[model samples]
Target: MPAEKKAYPLRISPAVLEAMQRWADDDLRSVNAQIEYVLREALRKSGRLKPGQAAPVADDQDDST
Candidate 1:
């Protein structure tokens, strides 16, 4: 069975939002998905998302958790 989905609000600057939208389109993902992807990658690269850390269950998983 698939995991449950959760929604959370995020606030960002207009410029950042626009950049995310463009990146999402380029990657064939939605704006929300793109943001989560980027954040996950960032965390992983920074060592914050270690192997033991819970993996993102899906593309739309809430990364802020």
Candidate 2:
């Protein structure tokens, strides 16, 4: 069974929201899912989460070039 997800209100700047929207569109994910993916990657990279608890490291793919 999947873990239960909790809902939390997020306050974000319009610019950031717009950027995330664009990225989410490119990745074919909802804005919420994109945000969660980025957050998980950050946590994994920072050693805040165990390797098994988070996704594998994705290849470096910079879209803002």
Candidate 3:
């Protein structure tokens, strides 16, 4: 079965949003999926993700720490 989709609310500048939209179209993904894919790649590159592990959730409380 396919995995469930999760919705995340984020604030970004219009320029960034535009860029993401273009990128998403180029990659044949929705804007939301592109963002998730980027985050997953970043986490993996930063050594914060193990092989086959899921991406970590970014909690609102995390900003305060």
Candidate 4:
């Protein structure tokens, strides 16, 4: 089972959105999913994510991206 997600309205510049969309396409993810992925990575790198609790892995996909 997946954890529930909370929804929030975010405001961003068009250029930033465009760049993120392109990056998301490159990573084979939807824009929203890519945003979550980047955010999770940033959180992990900064030690904001709890120790031993990491982002969920995609069973069939390589996580090289």
Superposing all C-alpha atoms, what RMSD in Å does each candidate have to the true structure?
4.4, 7.7, 8.5, 5.6
lDDT (C-alpha) at residue 8 in model 1? 76
The lDDT of model 4 is 0.71
Best by TM-score: 2
Candidate 4 TM-score, C-alpha based:
0.76
Residue lDDT tens for model 3, 1-65:
34445556699999998999899789767777677779888889999977788743433222221
lDDT of 4 by residue, 6-47 (tens): 666788899988999899889777667777778888888998
Which segments of model 4 are wrong by more than 4 Å? Answer: 51-54, 57-65
The Cα error of candidate 4 at residue 28, in Å, is 0.7
**Alpha-carbon local distance difference test for all models:** 0.71, 0.72, 0.69, 0.71
Give a tens-digit lDDT track for model 1, residues 1-65.
55665677888999989988888789877787777678778889999888746555365543432
Tell me how candidate 3 scores on lDDT: 0.69
**1-65: candidate 2 lDDT, tens digit per residue:** 34456567889999999999999889877777788789998887898977788553232432331
Question: Candidate 1 overall Cα lDDT vs. reference?
Answer: 0.71
- As for candidate 3, its clashing pairs are none
| Segments in model 1 whose C-alpha atoms lie over 4 Å from true places | 52-65
Candidate 4: Cα lDDT at 38: 85
